[model samples]
Target chain A: MLKAIWDNIKGLYSLLVGLSITGRYLVSPRKTIHYPRQVVDDEILASFRGPLELTRGRKEPGQTRCISCQMCVRACPGHCLTVIKGDAKAPSRWIYDFSLCCLCGACVEACPAGALAFSHKVYLVATSREELKLDLLADLKARTEKEAPPKNE
Target chain B: MDLSLAIFVQIIVAVLLIIGLMVGNAVVMVYMERKVAGFIQRRPGPYEVGPWGTLQAVCDSMKLLAKQVFLPGNVDFILYYLAPILAFLPVLLLFLPVPFGPILTPLHINEGIVLILAFAGLGVLSNLLAGWSSNNKYSLLGAGRAVAQTVAYEIPMILALLAVVLQSGSMDLAKIVGQQGQYPWQWNIALQPLAFFIYLVSLVGETNRAPFDLPEAESELTAGFHTEYSGMGFALFFLSEYANMLLVSFVCASFFLGGYKGPFLDGIWWTFIKAYLIMFFIVWIRWTFPRVRFDQLLNINWKWLLPLGLLNLWLTAVLVKFLV
Candidate 1:
C-alpha cells in the first residue's frame, strides 16, 4: 500500500515536470521563419542542388569549361545528358533533358574538365514535359553574350 | 404577482446576449487553443488571414458553414438530428447560473450549483446519442467509453465541489464568490488546494478533453461520437465543446480563484482573467500530455481522484464544523 502511494506521487511529480518543460517552451522565441514573407538569400538557397548547370570558364568568362570528350553523357546514369561532339576550342551543343535527370551528380563528379556544377535555380517546378527538356548550349551562349558584350566599335 | 413586460424584455435581451457570447467564445477559444499549442511547440501557429491570424477562427466558421451537410444513410434519422441540438443546447442554460460579475450572470437562482451540474450532466447524453445514432462501430465504442469516463469522473468532481459548498456554507454561486476575497491568499484555491486540484483533474475528464480524450481519440476513433456529422452538425458540436470549455473555466474561476474580485476592479474582468488562466492551463496540459489509456484513465479517477476527493471533503467538513 505504501509503495502504491509512492508510485502515485512520483507519477504526479512527472506530470508537473512535463508541464514545466512545455511552459518554458511557450515563452521561448518562435522558430517559424514565415516561409513566403521572409526567404533566406538565394546564395544560401542556391547552394542547395536545384539542377545541373555548366561551369563558366575561368579564362574566358561565361564560356563553358567543357572539352567535349562526351565523358558526362557516358557517366550519366539517367542518360539525360546529350552532348554534340565539337573541337576543344568550339562551343558544343549540350541538351540536358531535366525531366529524366535524377540529380545523382555523377556527371558533375565524372567531368574531368570540371565543366558542371549545380544550378542556383532552386524553384524548378515545371508543368509540361517539354519544359523539362533544357538546352544547355543555348543557356551557355546567352550567358556568354550577356557577360562578354561585343565592344561597340 | 403580476408579470412585468420590462422584466420579460430584460430576460429576452440577456438570453440573446448569452447566445451571442457562445459564438464569440468559440472564435476566441479556437484561436487561443491553436496559438497556445503552437507556442508550446516553438511554432508561430496561424500568422496569416488577419494580424497574427486573429481572424482565422472567423475563416474556419465560414469554411465549416460552406461544407455540405453529409449525413450517412445508416444513421438513425431522428436521433442523428437531435444529437447535435442536445450537444449544444444545454450549454446555453449552463451559463445562466455562472457569476461572471457581482451584478452579471443572466439568471440568479439560490441553487446555482444544482442548476449548473444538472445541465452539465446533459452533455454526456448528447455524446452517447451522437455515437450511438451514427451506427459506426468506432462511434458506438466512443459513446460507451464517454459514458463510462463521465460516470467515473463526475463523483470525485461533485465531492470536491461539495467540499467547497460546505466551506462556503451555501449553494448560491454569487455567495460562494463573495466568501473569497480580492487577493490570492484569500482565494478558495489557497484555502482548498486539494479540492481545487481534484476539480482540475476532474474538469479535464468531465469535458472529455485530452489525456482523458479517449472518446474522440483521433488516432483510434476517427472523430469519435461526431464521426458521421458534417457541416452544421459538426459546427454545433464544435461550438458546444468550446462553450463547455468557457463554462468550465468560469466555474473554475468562480469556485476556486475568487470570481470577479481583483485588486482595483471588483467586477467581471477579474472573472474573465481567472477563467482564461484556467482555460490556458487546460489548453497547455492538453498539448503537454498524451491521451491516457482507457484503463489508466478510469484508474486515475477511481483509485486516486475519488479517494482524495472524499478525504478532502471529510476533512473540510471536520475543519468547518470544529474550527470555522
Candidate 2:
C-alpha cells in the first residue's frame, strides 16, 4: 500500500514533466513549412524521386542514350514501359503508362544503355487516367527540339 | 441603479451581450482549436480564408448555416428539435453567478455554486433527448455514455468546489472570489492543491473532451449523438461544446485561480488571460493524450476520482475546523 502511494506521487511528478515539455514547444519556433506561401528548397528536394523519363546524351547533342534496347521493357514488373524500336538509329517512339508504374525503380536499374533516370522537376498532375498515359518519345522530341535551337535559321 | 425599469433594461442588455459573446466565443474557439491542433502536428492550420486563417471560423459558421436541415427517417420531431436548444440554453444561466470583473457581473446571487451546479446537471437531459430522438443505436449508446460520464465526473467537480467553499465559508461565487488575495501564494489553488487536481480532471471529463471523449468517439460512434443532426442542429451542439469550455474555464478561474485578481492592474483582462491559459493547457493535453476506453473512463471516476474527492473534502473540513 505504501509502495502504491509512492508510485502515485511519482505519476504526478511525471505529469508535470509532460506539461513542461509541451510548454517548451508552445514557445519554441514553429516547425511548420507553410505550403503555397513558402515552398521547400530544391536542395532538400534533390533526393526526391518522382517519375521516369529518358535521359539525353550529355556529350552528343540532340541524341538520346537509348540504343533501342528492350532491357527496360522486359524487366518492368508493372509493364509501364513500352519501347517501339523504330528504323535503325531513328528516334524511337516510347509510350510510358504512368498509371501502372509502381515507381519501384526496377526499370531504371535494368536499363543496360543507361537511358533512364528519375526527375521530380515535373511533378505529375493529370485530371484523367488517359492523361497519365504519357507519350515519352514525343515529349523527348519536343525537349530536344527546344534544346536544338533554331535549325531553320 | 435601484430604479426597477433601469434594472430591467440592464438585464435585457446583459442577456443580449452574453448571447452575442456566446456565438463570438464559438467562432474564436473553432479557429483557435484548429490552429493549435495544426501547430502541435507541425503544420500550418487553415491559412487560406483570411490572413493566417483568422476568418476561417466565420467561413465555417457560414457553411454550417447554409447547409440543409436534414432529418433522417423516423425521428421524433419535437425531441429532436428541442435537444440542441436545451443543450445550449441552460449554459447561459450557468454564466450568471460567477463574477467577471469587480463591477462586471451580469447577475449576482447568493448560493451561486448551487445554482451553477443545478443548471450544469440539466445538460444531461439534453444528451438523453438527443440520443433517444435520433432513433439510432449509436446515438443512443453515445448519449448513454455521455450521461454516465457527466454524472460520474460531476461528483468530483462539486466536491472540489465544495472544498473551496468550506475554505471560504460562503456559497456565493463572488464572495469566494473576494476571499482570495491578488498574489499567487494566497490563491485557493495554493490552499487546496488536491481539490484543484480533482477539479482539473473532472473539468476535462465533464466537458467530454479528448482522453475522455468516448461518447463522441469518431472511429466507433461516427460523430456520436450528433450524427443524425445536420446544418444548424450540428452547429448548435458544436457552439455549446465551445461555450461549455469557456464556462468551465470561468468556473476554474473564479473558484481556484483568483478571478479578476492579479498583481498591479486588476480587472477583467486578468480573468480572460487566466481562463485562456487554462484553455490552452486543456487543448495541449487533448492533443497529447489518446482517448480512454469506456470501461476505463468509468473506472477512473468511480474507483479513483470519487474516493480521492471524499478524502480531499474530509481533509479540507478537518483543516478548516481546527486551523481556521
Candidate 3:
C-alpha cells in the first residue's frame, strides 16, 4: 500500500514533467514555412522529380539529344510517351501524356542519348487531363528561347 | 415580496450580456485552442483567415451558421431539438452567481455555490437526452460515459469546494471572495492545497476536457453525443462546452485564486485576468496530455481524489474548530 502511494506520487510528478516539456515547446519557434509567402529552399527542391522534360543538347541549347530510338516508348510502363521520327535522327514530335505517366523514371533511365530527365516543376497544376498532355519538343524550344537572350548578354 | 423596476431591468440586461459573453468566449477559445495546439506541435495554426488568423473562428462560426441542418432519419424530434438548447441555457444561469468583482455580481443570492452546482448537473441531462434521442449506438455510449464521469467527478469537486466553504464560513461567492487576501500566498490555494489540487483534477473531469474527454473521444466515439448534430445544433454544443469551461475557471478563480482580488487592483479586470489564465492552463494541458482510459479516469476520481478531498475537508474542519 505504501509502495502504491509512492508510485502514485511519482506518477503525479511525471505529469508535471510532461507539462514542463510541452510548456518549453509552447514558446519555442514554429517550424512551418508559411508556403505561399515563402518558397522552400532550392537545396531541398533540387532532388524533386515532378514531370519528364527533354534535356538540352550539349552542342546547341535548342537542339534535342534524342535520336528517335523508341527505347523510352518501350520502357514507359504507362505508355505515356510518343515519338514521331523525322528524316534525321532528331524527333519531329515528342508527346508526353503526364496524366498517364507514373513518374517511375524508367523512361529517363532507358534513354540511350541521355535526352530525358525529371524537371523540378513542383508548382505544376492542371484543370483537366488534356492540359496534362505535354509536347516536350515545344517545351524545350520555349525554354531554349527564354535562356538565349540571357546567355547573349 | 416586491421586485423593483431597476432590479428587473438589471436582471434582463445581465442575461443579455451573459449571452454575449458566452458567444464571444466561444469565439476566443476556438482561436486560442487551435493556436496553442499548433504552437505545441511546431506549426502555425489558422494564419490565412485574417491577420494572424484572428478572424478564423468568426469565419468558422459563419460556416457553421450557413451549413444545412441535416437531421438523421427517425430521431425523437422534440428531444433532438431540445438537447443543444438544454446544454446551452443552464450555462447562462451558472454565470449569474460568479463574483466577477467586489460589486459586479449579476444575481447575488445566499446559496450561490449550491445554485451553480445544481444547474451544472443539467448539462449532463442534455448529453443523455442528445444521445438517447439520436438513435445512434455511439451517442448512447458517449452519454453513458458522460453521466458516469460527471457524477463520479462531482463528488470530489463538491468535497473540494466544501473545504473552502468551511474555511470561509459562507456559501455566498462574493463573501468567499471577501474572505481571501488580495495576494497569491494568502489565497485558499495556500491553506488548502490538497483541496485545490482535487478541485483542479475534478474541474478537468467535469468539463469533459481532454485527458478525461472520454465522452467525446474522437477515435473511439466519433464526437460522442453530438455526432448526429450538425450546423447550429453542433454550434450550440460547441458554445456551451466553452462557456462551461469559462464558468468552472471563474469558480476556481474565486474559490482558490482570490477572485477579483489581485496585488495591484481589486476589480473585474483581475477576475477576467485570473479566469483567462486558468482557461489558458486548461488549453495548455489539453494539448499536452492524451485522453486517459475511461476506467482509469474513474479510478483517479473514486480511489484517489475522493479520499484526498475528504481528508482535506476533515482537516480544514478540525483546524477551523479548534485552531481558528
Winning model by DockQ = 1
In angstroms, the error of model 3 at B319 is 1.8
For model 2, the stretches where C-alpha displacement exceeds 4 angstroms are A56-62, A67-71, A74-80, A89-91, A99-106, A109-114, A126-133, A138-153, B1-9
Could you give candidate 3's per-residue lDDT for residues B1-324 as a string of tens digits? 257877788788889999999999999999999999999998998898889999999999999999999889989989999999999999989999899988999989889999999999999999999999999999999999999999999999999999999989999999999989988999999998998899999999999999899999999999999999999999999999999999999999999999999998899999999899999999998988999998899999999999999898899999999998
Candidate 1 A-chain TM-score: 0.73
In angstroms, how far off is B142's CA in candidate 1?
2.3
Task: List the lowest-lDDT window of 10 residues for candidate 1 chain B.
Answer: B1-10
Query: For residues B1-324, what per-residue lDDT tens digits would candidate 2 score against the true structure?
Result: 568788788677777877887998888888888888877766678888989999999899899999999989999989999999999998888888778897888877889889888998888888889999999999999999999999999999999999999989999888888999898888999988989999999999998999788788898999888889999999989988888888899999999999999898879998889988888878888877778899878877887789999999999999999998
Tell me the TM-score for chain B of model 3: 0.98
lDDT score, candidate 2, position A143: 76
Name the runs in model 3 displaced over 4 angstroms.
A55-77, A86-90, A106-115, A141-153, B4-7
Off-target runs (Cα >4 Å) in candidate 1 are: A42-47, A55-91, A99-117, A125-128, A137-153, B1-11
Candidates, ranked, lDDT: 3, 1, 2
lDDT of 1 by residue, B1-324 (tens): 246776677678777888998999889899999999999999998788899999999999999999999888888989999999999888988888788899987777899988888888899999899999999988999999999999888899899999999999999889999988989899899989999999999999998899889999999999898889999999999999988888988988899999999787799889989888888888999999999999999989999999999999999999999998
> Which DockQ-derived CAPRI band holds candidate 2?
acceptable
> Cα lDDT of all candidates, in order?
0.89, 0.85, 0.94
Clashes of each: 0, 0, 0
Better of 2 and 3 by lDDT: 3
